[model samples]
Target chain A: MKTDQEGAVRSDALLSSWKQTPTRQAIVDYVDRALQEGGAEYVPPSERVAVFDNDGTLWCEKPMPPELGFILQRLAEMAEQDPSLRTRQPWQAARDKDYAWLGDVITKHYHGDDSDVRVLMGGILQAFAGMSVDAYAEIADRFLRTTPHPTLGRQLWRCTYLPMVELLRYLEANGFTTYIASGGDRDFMRPVTEELYGIPAERIIGTTAGLRYQDDDTGGSVVYQAEMEVFDDGPTKPVRIWSRVGRRPVVAGGNSNGDIQMLRYAGQPSRPGLRLLVLHDDEEREFNYTAGAETSLEQARAQDWTVVSIKNDWATVFADEV
Target chain B: MKTDQEGAVRSDALLSSWKQTPTRQAIVDYVDRALQEGGAEYVPPSERVAVFDNDGTLWCEKPMPPELGFILQRLAEMAEQDPSLRTRQPWQAARDKDYAWLGDVITKHYHGDDSDVRVLMGGILQAFAGMSVDAYAEIADRFLRTTPHPTLGRQLWRCTYLPMVELLRYLEANGFTTYIASGGDRDFMRPVTEELYGIPAERIIGTTAGLRYQDDDTGGSVVYQAEMEVFDDGPTKPVRIWSRVGRRPVVAGGNSNGDIQMLRYAGQPSRPGLRLLVLHDDEEREFNYTAGAETSLEQARAQDWTVVSIKNDWATVFADEV
Candidate 1:
């Protein structure tokens, strides 16, 4: 973190991941004007909210999303206990190590198809049922920090996009409260958000497992019930954001159609809304696929939103590389 | 707000509401130790959470809760349009100005009787359904700011207990983020919390009307649906607290059986927990009835929690009285 003449903190080291392109300049420019005391783009410190999508926007989702990586291991163990579970899918797919079926479930969800997503949620609810929130959070924290990505040969947390990490720090330095609004499980993301992205547990807005509070001779604790209360994708994103933050985000970042509602809700015609749409077009540097991001990509182009080309904008894809 | 010799902030005027009793001393002692750097009770900035119940704890719930006041008015308006609605419960009670029936329903709910609570909820769901969040917030804000208390004759916001208002400011000066956790509707409480108390819209946790987000050529907006997703009371208060803050609160204040689980959830056995149970024993200055608070008073005696006597401890009841 470096300080400018105005004493506003700037992160030259953090910003090094992005190339000096127009896309990078636009991000800096929006934040710069927001900091101007009486400038037209100036937003009060309290109103500066930035929401980022987790799965494919801030981190890698190829081969599989990291949460799926965590969930699959749990599902496989559960299937091993009850072999009859192998007859149904996502349990069967997990037991067989079928990435294609798991990946398809996610893609189908982005395309507004929830049939496979429901099947996957059924396995998810069973995999973690009755586990205390603290216990599950501890296990997830350990998994994210220790377990290697399936194809990336790196720890799950290390797969986070270096450029977006810089943007979070920059926004935070500029007085914006950053939040993770994603389709991933809230508990799954919260345990690792601060370590991976500088966001705290309370700022994570995501789909959640049904929670039941229990009291006994001992103290009270919350447990995961075998129910997916809300999927928190598509239409549910805006509702979660408003309920959690009580303000519309001035900026939104996304890579999939699941974030369409959030991206659309970002800015008014007169207000400053900066949307960054990450395009995974670099096959060599990182996994590249547009299956889940097709509509997001098309809308980004049509609306003249910032289409961030991974191959063109980012000088380094991962912090480890930089 | 004032600063002490050590340059730490304090509020002499706010504290003037409370008499210099041991109960007030205990409140100050807990905050002092929490602010003492490197001391045993010192808490970091982020984890200092204080949850307060709204209706009875923070303000006067007498003559019925303020939200019930707002809902009753709406119910009466709706009944005028459809006379058939007068046949059923809550609407019938509201339409008739039968304060006896309305007050009995609240008291029965505290004794673990939710039958009447359900009827009241049915009225609440229909009263504000199909209204956009912004539209509903505006109406609630106006009602809370303008409506006079039925018996006290004070404006709704000024009905807040003066001593608790001081505690909110004192805690805020010392870096605690206060929240309102109640059985009242989240949207209904949010609009008036900041002006009435020092808390913000995001920090108000309560039962919610189901929310649906709509998008069109203009933009996206969220509307309240008629469904009551979860009645945020009793066992559910802890669930709502955990879901909202992702941490157990250090301090809690309440005045009824509805807040038992929340007060119980305040502090862990090993951690610092300060529970304040307000005893409404002052009929001269305020309403005096222990009907709904029967169990809370019993538990306060058994557990040795701070039993705040409005008649004995308060130097003043309302801020305007000063």
Candidate 2:
């Protein structure tokens, strides 16, 4: 509500929850310039589309993504219910908490044949495919409430980056239609996205499986199928964005090479756009390993994107209560 | 800007552009009751989702869908450039404006193997594959500006229903997030949806083709592919709605059997919902044929849904200027 020297409302106050750093300043300046009524870069409120990558950009993805942890836990529960699942490949690995095997599977997913990844993803999806969406949401909610982060010793949902939460609010206040474009399962993210980041389920675009519609003695419901519909990673990110959002985003934020295509799509030469990369370099507050982020970091430097170093730029990482 | 009897702001003034009829009154009352603070049926702003079927609900689709017309025109243009295309089955049918062949193709699409439909859609998509989204949008805009409705003697874009336009604005003013869920091509609708309706491109969901991302000497762009990713009709409508919108709509409006599943999805037994069917029974203002909509009308009566009679309920169909 504060006004500037020319009696225009200043936007920096909206980001008071964010630390005063070069990275935050750049975002405020860019938003201000883009919102100025008569400025060359001024984009109308309707056209202010901003997309953010979920896992590493908005929340902690250090030891592993929280969804992976949930999937493993769910697999273990299923194994306990059905003893036969304990003998299965992916379920056995998950039940035993075999990080090496899981890591090998993930590596094979990225470098080796896609069938390996498909097997893992397919098994995970098949585990809970027949449940109603409401029931699945309840399971996610229960997991989020009871499970603690491996290293942070807090609830998994509470481990979200405080600065990014404030950034989402700040952009929304400036009339930017924000969306979460993630590689995570769409249903998995929907249960907590609104509560955590003020993003509704519809505003979330993610990897998905096909769904089947049914109306029998149990009444009508849509059931999730084990079939993978859209992978929604790397180049497919931009394609899904185009398919669902139908507009090229004016701003994009990410922290991995999986988001390179989305970032490049947002930062097109024909229009003014902003690309932000969040760097995890604070070992004290968060993890500091960048094993898979080398290409992303190189591209950020080469393209002169706004790089937010957690150690230097964030006054806080997780909320105090969290 | 007007106030009601209790000195509270009333949103009905926003719909003054609409006709004063029982159908309009029903919608206004329903919205007002649902939005009342202490009402039993009160819905939060974030959960106020309203979805509409585009082709027949929002605009005129008499002789055929306007997109079909546009596709035929494009096919004829291609036939001129490539002489060999004149002998191609789908292309030749479109080029010659052979209604019998086109009707057979459409009937086969609905009843025959999916691959038959795929062949037709693939050809239509391939006709414009590799074109940049912006360039394709320009082509849609040019076609919309130049082409007139065969019977109406006005531009196709000008043939939209006025009452429905007011309803879209009214719902939006009441904090409902409006989405157009159509069976039309996704890319074809994006160019004109924003200008025609207040809804933005991101809120529009429809059938889509695959896209490819490439960065060559001419800079970076996403190109359309000759692939049919989703055929959003009938049962597929609800599936796509669940896939993209995530939330089931509280209000749904449509005009044909293709929208039956979507309307049923919206009118779930667990929640308070509205299902509206626009009956094309007006011979003077619009077409009077219900060749394919008999099932929808019967379902509307059986389900006790709101049946909007165009002849009796609408004071105006299209704008006077149009």
lDDT of 2 at B163: 84
Clashes of each: 0, 0
Which digits, one per residue and each the tens of the lDDT, describe model 1 over residues B192-270? Answer: 7887787888789998889988987545788888888878888899888888888778889998888887888787766
Mind giving the per-residue lDDT tens digits that candidate 2 earns over A17-84? Answer: 55788888788877877777767677777778899999889989868788888889888888888899
User: What are the Cα lDDT values of the candidates?
Assistant: 0.84, 0.79
lDDT of 2 by residue, B1-322 (tens): 2222321144456665556787777787778766776666666677688989998899998777888888888888888889899998668887888878766665555443466566567678878888877788888788877788989878897989988887888788777889888988877888888888988788888987778877653226778887777778887787787777777788999988788888887746545777889999888889886766778888889887788888888878898766
Docking quality of model 2: it rates as: medium
Clashing pairs in model 2? none
Model 1 misplaced stretches (Cα beyond 4 Å): A1-14, A33-42, B1-14, B33-44
User: How far off is residue B82 in model 2, in Å?
Assistant: 1.2
Off by over 4 Å in 2: A1-12, A16-20, A36-40, A107-115, A216-219, B1-22, B37-40, B103-119, B217-219
| Best-performing candidate as measured by DockQ | 1
